[model samples]
Target: MTTPSARVVLKPKRARPLFAGHPWVFAQSIARVEGSPEPGDEVEVVSHEGATVGRGLFNPSSAIRARLYRWDGGPLDDAFWKARLETAVQLRRDVLGLDARNSAYRLVFSEGDGLSGLTVDRYGSCLVALFSSLALHRRRDAILDALRELTGAEGIIARPDRAVAKEEGLDVGDVRIVGTIPEDLTVFENGLSYKVDVLQGQKTGFYCDQRENREAVARYCLGKRVLDLFCFTGGFALNAAKAGAASVRAVDSSAPALATARENARINEVANVEFEQGDVPKILERLKAAGERFDVVICDPPKYAGHARDLAPALGAYARLNHAAVDVLSPGGILATCSCSGLVDRATFRDVLANVAEHSRRPVQILEQRGQGPDHPVSAPCPETDYLKCLIARVG
Candidate 1:
């Protein structure tokens, strides 16, 4: 590797995790800096005893002061970025064959693919890239060039993750377009079609991570009354309806999302789904008051806890949602609930379910515990990459 601009020395006995493959080197773990390394600059990580741990990006303002992507002390050069992008694409195209079955899926999942702070999701012919690392953001030209060559994507849409930019003290601009991107883009999965608004929609226009969980939960929807809460683009509801559910009622607060979902239903000729635009919990209460019950209920919510501090409230919110879901579920019905908060681990999520069962006075049996699709592979060292949790349970 080229000589680093600076060297970060870790505190005593703090080098094990970085050596064992954890990618983060927090400010607290750092003892001193030999030279002034500006944010996004490549720096060598060293032990107090002068052992070189590796090299990584330095961001003093963030709690995760550094993000280590190289254990071999390789240079973060043009060739390095190209090779990383190629590996991510090859996993999806060759190893998983995700393109044969689905058009929209996560091509690169930041730390999951060993490229920290960069996430790329493919929406048909166009690719949406979100840069959370200043190093990668500053090197967008090279990143985009490598991606284009690797994926043959017509164009790229580089959007800013506002929250991340703020956390890292970055100056993120508006959306950038590299080449041609079609306005009317559609993605197919599990033989179902959905309209995607990559430019103005949420998180690259679709929830590509839930592609597999949608199918797994649909197995119990056949010949049943289904309720899909937070049904963004009606993924679960549409899958349930396609699986021969007797009827499907989907709810989401975003009108545009519901509109696109309705359009998706229309395109698929799905007549069993009824779209509703309103708060999910309030709608659940209304359904309970009307003496309505469903054989299956899906509660796939947004990320409630993005950080450690929000975990308590996130679990409480989950408990309340699950309790309400049980209120309208038929005896011995299925409840497919999910959480995309990386900070909320599986054990803590189970505790939330436990609280729901205790208060709702219903026995909740976990039928299956699933996660994001194969395309969104989890890096063993970075547990945060395994964020999406779909717990298929039978409530009795």
Candidate 2:
């Protein structure tokens, strides 16, 4: 058996053995490039000793230097894609127990499912795939064909993420790879119905990642005053109200989202909930000035750490949000704060809340630490699969 020579050399600081096969290779890690590898070129990433480390897509212009497609020398061809797609499909079929009632779930979760830089979420028979990397975006047609063959899904929608594309030096757009894609999608989460705008809404039109945590919040909302900050479409707030909360206040900066929240509340015919459209932090300040407090506080903020450099500032944002939330929580009230930042791990998330408690001089007891639901399964090899971190703490 012959050996493949090193095509690209990773900086001593860059080649970290992928730590259980993470697919990302940062630009700073590349020491030198032996040949001309284009943005979507498949190159052999190797150590200084000419050992074949892995096969990944090379992009010199992007912050992410490369995204490993496979490590075991599998060619990135139709057969390889079909096999991977079938495996991803089989996982949902067998592991998730997919049936008529719960036909919607995550089909492929990027690096978690061995498909780097690609995210596919299934809504019933319709599949929505998000491409955040240039390499994956360039290979959309082949991926779509593989998806169709593997799942026979009624529709396959391609949603190229603009934020990610910008970083990857690619253009962003939406297209229907298979059948017709629905403009509005309704899926049940924890026995609640939610409308997803797959064409225009945020991150595949629904926060499917929070399905488990929403149910977790429902368990503790019995006859309590619940306040949901950054309540997008009022998923947490409505769940609380449905769980017999005395009152629910849902606050968001987007008026349209607030309107949708009201529609959702009305759709469920829940009357004990109120929606506020304004800056959440400002609203929290006003509530504090008015001497208002909540029995259960839910703060689920968007990703403050889109990149590695944003980690510190994002942690500060989380801390400030938690401090404000804990300050307005009633004595012995429950505080459930969460962050979806990929760069922020569970330990950092816990430390962020701890810092908030210290700053506010509050004694906190952790009730539970929550992450993504089973539908969004985390691969044992990929730690980034477990991105969401929720801390259910009680502050006295």
Candidate 3:
């Protein structure tokens, strides 16, 4: 008869607006299943009205039940991959003008580019591809082939070190796809050089998401003695020092990241920065106890909340970090704080900062607020569209 169909049919309530182009289908929204489907199974998503909405990978265990890859009812063959890969490359070149810059940039940004859960970063001649979803990991050969055929860059490497893969029930592994991917590479941003450790560093070697934020911070850091807390690879510290900061101390627990941070400073020939490897909380405590104050402080911590349940503890961490940051700020000094946790919305982050200021008894005025750079665009209807939230405030 018919090949045993594996698909999900949404209920009326579940399908109401999903057909409107939302990429995510929540687990609670699933109404019925036509046949047995394993996690990461490719399926046809249908509305209650019996209209096909899209083709996606189904992950029953995940809150995100389905991640839509193509809304048009079409075969996902080699042609589809070729077209999507080309479009992804062209978007960066045509829309973001990435060709004019030699610095690293996101080649693919998951759902933002309509390719769910696939992230790629280009560092000089090297490429780091992150395949977090089982759907993409299964098709790793084709994806790698597309990268080789399309970009023709020097090298392509796989970065499955991210935690997202574990949620998809996949084991993490690092694979070298093509060419010679170095252990350490250098990237230029805003005329400053940063040494990136692709094998061990965070998210595809460098924080491409913070490109614009670093540029903005560089504008205000001149003549300031800055303290960068939770400074992985010292992106902010380098920016601040390159902007003529009197001095900068970059702190992180990973000695490897700090070592790269030091090399990054040296690459830029910026001599004013110092790297300290330790726990950020303890370091902050010691600094405050030592009566050491800074004219500018940057707190860019990792994701404290991966989900809604983690928000309480995340807020506590944010508050404690900002409290110490504020306590050691010189009068009228600036504090640039950021939270990468998608669960921590802008409102919640601002509230926590205000609470920190209140607790520290410091008079604070917010100078500016920013989200992820233009490269990381947000969809209007999706709350998850925005992730990075940063606040630049002056404390007295």
Q: For candidate 1, lDDT tens digit of each residue in 1-396?
A: 377979999999999888888888998999998899888889999988999898898987888888898889789888988999999999999999988878999999998998888889997789999888777787889999999998889989997776688888766666689999898998899999999998888877899889889999899998999999999899999999999999999999999999999999999999999999999989999999999999999999999998889988988899999999999999999999999999988988888888888888899999999999888888897788889999999999
- Model 2 lDDT tens row, 172-205: 7555567977666677766677776677667876
TM-score of 1: 0.97
- Superior by TM-score: candidate 1 or candidate 3: 1
- RMSD each, Å: 1.2, 2.2, 2.2
Q: How badly does each model clash, as a count of residue pairs?
A: 0, 0, 0
TM-score of each: 0.97, 0.94, 0.94
Error of 1 at 319 (Å): 0.8
Ten contiguous residues with the weakest lDDT in model 1 = 167-176
Give the candidate number with the greatest TM-score: 1
C-alpha local distance difference test of each model: 0.90, 0.81, 0.82
Q: In model 2, where do residues sit more than 4 Å from their true spots? A: 1-6, 13-16, 100-103, 174-177
lDDT of 3 by residue, 176-286 (tens): 568888766778887877887787777787888888888787777899999998888878988898888999998999888888888877777888888998999898889
Considering only N, C-alpha and C atoms within 3 Å, which residue pairs clash in candidate 1?
none
Worst 10 residues of 3 by lDDT: 1-10
